[model samples]
Every structure is written in structure tokens, then in C-alpha cells.
Target: MDVKRISGLGRNAAGDLAKGVRQVGPGGQVIVVRPANSNFTLQEYQNFVNNFKPQQPGVTFRVVDEAALPK
Candidate 1:
């Protein structure tokens, strides 16, 4: 599976970016970087994940704090 990292983007923008990536038809994980000032809400994130579930069963998307990423 492919792994993608998306940072510095709001909810809508991040969703757009993820959708673009999904067009490639690769099932993978999308890691959204959640900063202190991020406007990405938990509900929005869940909706984003759920929205793609029906279309692409292999795709998995989630949000995480920037610090949680491995060096």
C-alpha cells in the first residue's frame, strides 16, 4: 500500500488533495498532519474517511499530530 503525508492544509483542501490521489486508484494510507492551529475538525475528518470508504474500499485515511510522525 502507498503511504501519503498531507500537511498545512485545511479540511476542504486536504480532502481535495486526497481525492486527487485517489484518482490514481491505489489503495493506501493518507496521514493528515494536525497542527495546533489546524482547522481540521474530528467530525470533518471522519466524514472524509467515510466518504471515500464506499468508493475505494482499500483506501484508509486518518489525521494525526505532526509530532506523532516518525523521524
Candidate 2:
């Protein structure tokens, strides 16, 4: 299965960023790593993940929130 990439930006902005893994596959794992915010909520995260779609069914899609690397 081809791997998909989702980029989560903005620190402490999970509301706008959306905080959860999207389209996770059976074997793949979605990794979220926003700037550890004390006020990050789960609902917003859910919204983020919900907006994503798997390119193909049973493809085992996964997400990863990484530290915004320097440009």
C-alpha cells in the first residue's frame, strides 16, 4: 500500500490544527506530535482526523504530527 503524508502546522493551535490521526490502517499507526500544549482538546483533534480520507480502502493509512522543522 502506498503511504500518505499529512502535515500538521501551528503550535498550540490544535483547534485550527486538528489533533488526531487520520485514516489509520490496521497495521499502520497515526502519530500526532503538536507542541505539547496544556490546553489542547480532543474534540478539535477528532475534527482534524475526520476530514481526511484514505486514497484506497484497506490501505492502512496513518498520520504523523512532527516537530515543525526549520525551513
Best model per TM-score = 1
- As for candidate 2, its clashing pairs are 19-45, 25-60
Model 2 quality (TM-score): 0.33
lDDT of 2 by residue, 2-56 (tens): 2323334334333322222234434444444434342444444445555644343
**Candidate 1 regions with alpha-carbon error over 4 angstroms:** 1-11, 14-17, 42-44, 53-55
* Whole-model lDDT per candidate: 0.55, 0.38
Error of 1 at 70 (Å): 4.8
The alpha-carbon deviation from the true structure for residue 39 of candidate 1, after best TM-score superposition, in angstroms, is 3.3
lDDT of 1 by residue, 1-71 (tens): 33434444456655665664576466756655555455766556556555553255566666666556677
**Over 4 Å off, model 2:** 1-27, 38-40, 59-71
Residue 59's lDDT in candidate 1? 63
TM-scores of all candidate predictions against the true structure: 0.45, 0.33
